[model samples]
Target: MQPHNRRTFLALGLLTLTAACTGSHRHDPDGGDQRPDPDQPVRLRAVAATDTLLAAYDALLAAPGAQTALLQPLRAETARHRAALTAGTPSTPSTPPPTTTSPTTPPTPTTPAALAVLERQTAQSRLADLGAAGPPLARLLASVAAANALHAAALGAPAEPPAPAATPTPTGTTPGTSAPALQKALSAEHAAVYGYGVVGAHLPEDQQRTDARTAYAAHQSQRDAWQRLLTTLGATPTPAAGGYRLPFPVTDPAGAVKLAAHLETGLTTVYADLVADLPAPHRPAAATALRDCALRAHRWGAPDTPFPGIPDPTDPSPTPTTPTTPTT
Candidate 1:
């Protein structure tokens, strides 16, 4: 036996024994162990949302003369979202049930407006789910949310009278939660979406129209989210008013741009408020949404706020030049 070699082997064996006793297969700091991922169940609601989206696409496809080719890709993407969410999320017996319930009403035939509306709704649900998720999964949910927003754009101009399905009303609230903050954000989203419609009509510049469309889709995504989250919590969402009075008569493209810009900037505050109210794991999502809104608002020509959405009571920005009066 080689004496030196034997000593080295003995030393190596002792080190292994020490580590085995002390460390005991500790969880990796970055990743995790075999124990179910805590964030796994957070994605179930997203899966359900994707499922709803897919169903809507299916219904749209069935209608006579609908643009099947245009919709097929969107349907495929939604299916992929559903698959990713279902695969990543754990279905352990101990976890809360995934909010995977189908709509109470049977699927109705789809119009372009209805389809666009559904796409926006599903996107919104994903936004909330994104906030609830942790990293990796959260990233996936964010991508899905973004994709859903784009899908709304691809649906093109809405047809005829808006046949928005009756979104479920929110019912109840749990204690020690951010319900009030969420409601405020939802209300802001509802108003901003309404405002954007008025903004879109008066868009004077060609480039501005592009910006308006993107911003409108973003609001639609978030608005739908507010609906689903509130409904799931059994709280009724605040419905949009029949109409909103503009601060000014948006008789020109410039007026449209100003309104669009204002809506986006205002929403930054609402999203920021939501981030503050949300639990730590979910804060990233709210923050991300805030950033997206801010960028869009900037594109619409909003001046930079030092704190973005934060209010400065002392140095308050002037009330939007647009009027706030409401009437038929």
Candidate 2:
């Protein structure tokens, strides 16, 4: 096994043991307790990690001039992640709560390249935690980790979860009448293709226009693949909608870029969920697809998160036959 794969395997084993040692309690419906829930210690740790990343973004915002100004969207995304982690902030009273020192120390990446490295590490760390998490949480973490790995690639740094070098292991599972994941991925791809058309129409610049065209083609190809997969599975795929609602109006080149980023970011979440729904041998491909969406989003200037697709204070799922993210 590759060194990276070996490390991930070890981490998964260790963390699964940790979760088994303390994951019996169910989430409390009441918000009355000042004490932290034992079952949610790791969830809390994930929250702390997000907080640290948000603090880093805040520091960047405090720095001087144009570079800092350019990072506003990225900062907003981090804030969003922090909010997502704890499922909205707890309404704490003024009294001092009992203390437990946090195990997670956020990455201190100062430069852009260093930041990319930090994100990659954060993603890998989450992948380790995935094994201990339940299906919902585990799938979400895997998706985020996959996104961060692609973030490293987008920034020209090494991928945190090493890219698979071996040929894919063929899936032996019998095709069923259901293929909800492929259908959903197909819908998302349809939206992506349509959205890119709008994006291309607005961008007059040669490079950006070319980028929009490329993205459009990619989405079309992906959509066709999903359709083919569904057809093979004896499932009838949903046809694309004639239109999609835009998150916001796109009036200019900058707006078009923002739209592109938003579409790709959303698609990453869709692909992540699809990863969980797939059979084991097919998961690596879905995981790869999830990362591909992240890479495309990064190109359009989406804020890089320590973990993508999850709500670390921002927002959201699963994958891979990596012998890690051992989803239940």
Candidate 3:
């Protein structure tokens, strides 16, 4: 095995052992204390190992000149490991609960529900990781991790406990129309594409210009996809404006970098909105895409905006403006 692969396996093995030593403790969604139970199956250790292995494979794929031949085999191995771990604890009806010694102590619950929850949580975490991580590898990892998370959730074993609200169906401008979140997202994409053009124009050198151009193309591709989706749903996409106002002057390379960063931030927020508004089956894709943007933005040195889930401070103003646009 390659040096990286060998190291990956060794690391995963250590992780598994560490988890085993800790015993099974379900993380309370409410941020309460863990309910530790020795009887709880240590399946999480194996599941975690699978995650590490998959992550390692992702890193390898991210490297330059990675072989397709290696990728397929690595993916296959990951799948096999996942299957083995999943099979060990098939979902079954919850058995009659045994009396627990304490609230902090988990009852000797049956295998199925716990396992299902673990799988779902794993998937969700992976998707979140994908969003937080950087680059070509980030996208690939996010895609796979999101898929796994969905699968785990479907198995009725969610890593995180379900929220009180039932999963909301996608809603939009009109009742039973495209989701509102999606419409907002399309607008955001339009803004990002426009912003990139403005920012790219001011880049000082050939390399900076080329990088901006490449990023612009990616945004365009995303914009086109959103547009197509909107058209299919009978909604008109938000048209790109003639001139998007920038938050600051793009008079120098630093200014160009700042503009690029802002564009990335916009893209991330838009993608996140899409993820939340999409129906369950479609959500994973949106989430993965949004994460990709966020990771990229981070790499580009964008200041982390407050989590978009929170109400924007400027929302109440009649003229809610973004950063000041640089006048030519």
Candidate 4:
């Protein structure tokens, strides 16, 4: 295994051990006090990590020739992350506010590459914590980690090499359990495969067509995997609709690119839910899929969000409309 993969595996094992040790407890009878929440430390650590990254962005933006156009969107995304992490966890006697570093007077030598490294490290750290977190927080951490991974790539950094997927263990369980989430993901992949065909047709550029083909192939593969998993689980995978109604018209290349972004953004949300639903050992694949979709969405000009799969409560925009399924 690669050094990073080994490190991640060790970290996850450690976190799992920690969770098992501390996750379940009752009121302290000796002092008649409540036990501390086990997830708090993990949450606080994540908040601190995000704050540090946000400060780095501040320092870099303060420096000369910082490429505001490129960095600004990323920075904004970090702020959204901050908001999400800090929402219910307020500063108190026990939990202090996350410390933020003021930009230095001269500001340290900060570059996009350095920031990308930070993003990658932060992402790994969050991934490590996944095993220790509660279902909701674990889902959030996975989403943020995925976002940071994409952020690293957007900064021109080498992509984080893919981790090996865990071997599937089909229990022959029914749809009332985790199989439903997998089925949902399969449905999204189906729509994505269909949408990419439309996108490829409208994209005039060779590179765009190539990207479309790659995305199409990827979705098809994912769809097949979901089907296999469902079959093993004794659940029937839903058949793809004859056609999906597009949310908007796609008559030109610009429109095609928009559709592509839309496809990925929708998939990210589906996979994020899968992250929360799957068993700990299996969650990594769903998280990776979420990250992949988020990166594709970013490249296709989708607006960045701190939480890729989950909707940000801070945004007041109306709920996004999903593609309607028409009868065959």
Candidate 5:
């Protein structure tokens, strides 16, 4: 199978599970007390929100002297978010239906930084919408939220201060079930910690080296956290491999930047899986981590993807899907 196709399946695997679990209940009037699918309203609100964002993009792009070079990529990402959110729904047409913005609507901010504030607001709303969704919709909403966060960074918005860490809940664990996914996440964190060491070594600029060092330290902290979480669940965490092979040779500063992007992009995918597989209480952490990965990946020159961790079918040169191999 093609690599991107496999990545797509990994990303959407939970949706298939969600469908099988819910499909039998759809037409059961005989059961007498039918409740509506809880995800429907949340999905609708998300779709509406994306439409508003697209309108803002259209307004910003149409304005005189707009910075198309920067704004256009962000806008393109927003469009892709819209497509992902509405993917399997009945109302989605093969061709996008025409859309028009009302004259009464206020114009979007002319400055890119100001526009980024709106992007951040959209991201917050997506997170807010997460509470009511089932696993399938929740995963998509998490990706959308993270993608908007990346868009905000792309537009030069100041980073919001990190939220205080919530105590990890043990609700998602079932003897052997959550262990494998948690272990997968831990394993990826292990790679990131090692990869950043290489990144720090090869990067030439002082500021870039400092950034690499900071990323390395952050991964260490996350790696340790995952270890503790696994222990708390009575599972052994996977130990870091002695060494990891770089997907591509990191022989220069340019290569270091690409390697950093590659590492974070891979972590983003692992966390996205945790968001889907773990319980609701655990999802916010996964979502936040996913956003952090997306932001760091973009900072290191990765092309902006609408669904940050998930491979974009539209991308000709998608990131590799397999975990980096360990070298003895």
Candidate 6:
């Protein structure tokens, strides 16, 4: 064969061999080739974050005086997020166990399968911390906690850890009721609704101002809903304060924009916690509200906080900090 022809034939042979080897590689049905072992660790880490957050929220709920009127709604909201994370989407079981156990100690299922379970558990724990809560509050907490216990059992986490212990009954209060956390959430909502006023005034007579007004109205509706819930529970909602303290003075249009941005951002974080603390059934509604707030905050140009799933705007480096107690 000619020298050029010999080289061409050898190159064709090498290409054929390469294609055969690549085709023989194992792949997921989605068509992406991946090592099964590495995939397992990634799944474990993602699932572990959900479980860890649930555990942390449970610990926080058990803390003394943690349950308050203002905090209950937040707790409920957080539970919903946890549920969405742990059981929002169903996933195929990568490693099926021989047998299922009690609900509180099941094997950890696949990431997508367990998202809702995690969201509900996290929210329930938060609700439990909100003391002097009512049937709606307790029902939400108990239901989510029960579901999470079932989830734990399904995931095969050791049942020996003991399910979250019952919170102490609030003294000089109606049976099975807490209100402080709810009160706090309502207070924050009031401030948020009021802050929008400052924000709206500063926006130029354009679409931005109109959008801000709509968000302000939504906050008003949320605030009113909390008030109704409180009233139904035989508790009076705290009146909106005459003056809300801004993080900074609103001196200019830019300053007003900044204040509005901060308001939505802070609310998003707080709502994230709320979504993390509620039961599965109530999660969808709470998540919708939380997401709306997040989108609005993003539109309003709020600064992002440090959390997974949020876009990272800084250098890729970890920072060390003192260990802090959990906030329900």
Q: Which candidate has the top score in TM-score? A: 5
Q: For residues 106-129, could you state the per-residue lDDT of candidate 5 as single tens digits?
A: 356667777788788888888776
Ranking by lDDT: 4, 5, 2, 1, 3, 6
Better of 2 and 3 by TM-score: 2
lDDT of 3: 0.46
- Segments in model 5 whose C-alpha atoms lie over 4 Å from true places: 1-37, 91-110, 160-167, 172-176, 313-328
Q: Candidate 3, residues 1-328: lDDT per residue as tens digits?
A: 0011111100111001100011113455576775553222333443554554455445446667755473545345455445533331333112212232556433322333443454444546555443333222233333344344433333344233212211223345324334455655655565666666666757765776776776677767766776776666667777644433445566776787777776665555445444434543455556655545654455467653322211222223343333322222
In TM-score terms, candidate 2 sits at: 0.53
The estimated TM-scores of all candidates read 0.43, 0.53, 0.45, 0.74, 0.77, 0.43
Question: Model 3, 266: alpha-carbon shift in Å?
Answer: 2.7
202 in model 6: Cα distance from truth in Å?
1.7
RMSD values, in order shown:
22.1, 13.2, 18.1, 10.6, 8.1, 24.7
lDDT by residue (tens digit), candidate 1, 161-214: 222322333334333376676776666676666666777767754777766766
Which scores greater on lDDT, model 3 or model 6? 3
Clashes of 3: 12
Query: What lDDT would each prediction earn against the true structure?
Result: 0.55, 0.56, 0.46, 0.70, 0.67, 0.44
Stretches > 4 Å off in candidate 2: 1-134, 150-178, 313-328
When summed lDDT is taken over every stretch of 10 residues in candidate 3, the lowest stretch is 11-20
Residue 263 in candidate 6 has what lDDT?
67
> Which residue segments of model 1 deviate by more than 4 Å?
1-176, 312-328
Off by over 4 Å in 3: 1-125, 128-177, 303-328
Question: Over 4 Å off in model 4, which ranges?
Answer: 1-36, 62-65, 91-109, 159-176, 315-328
Each model's backbone clash number: 13, 13, 12, 0, 0, 77
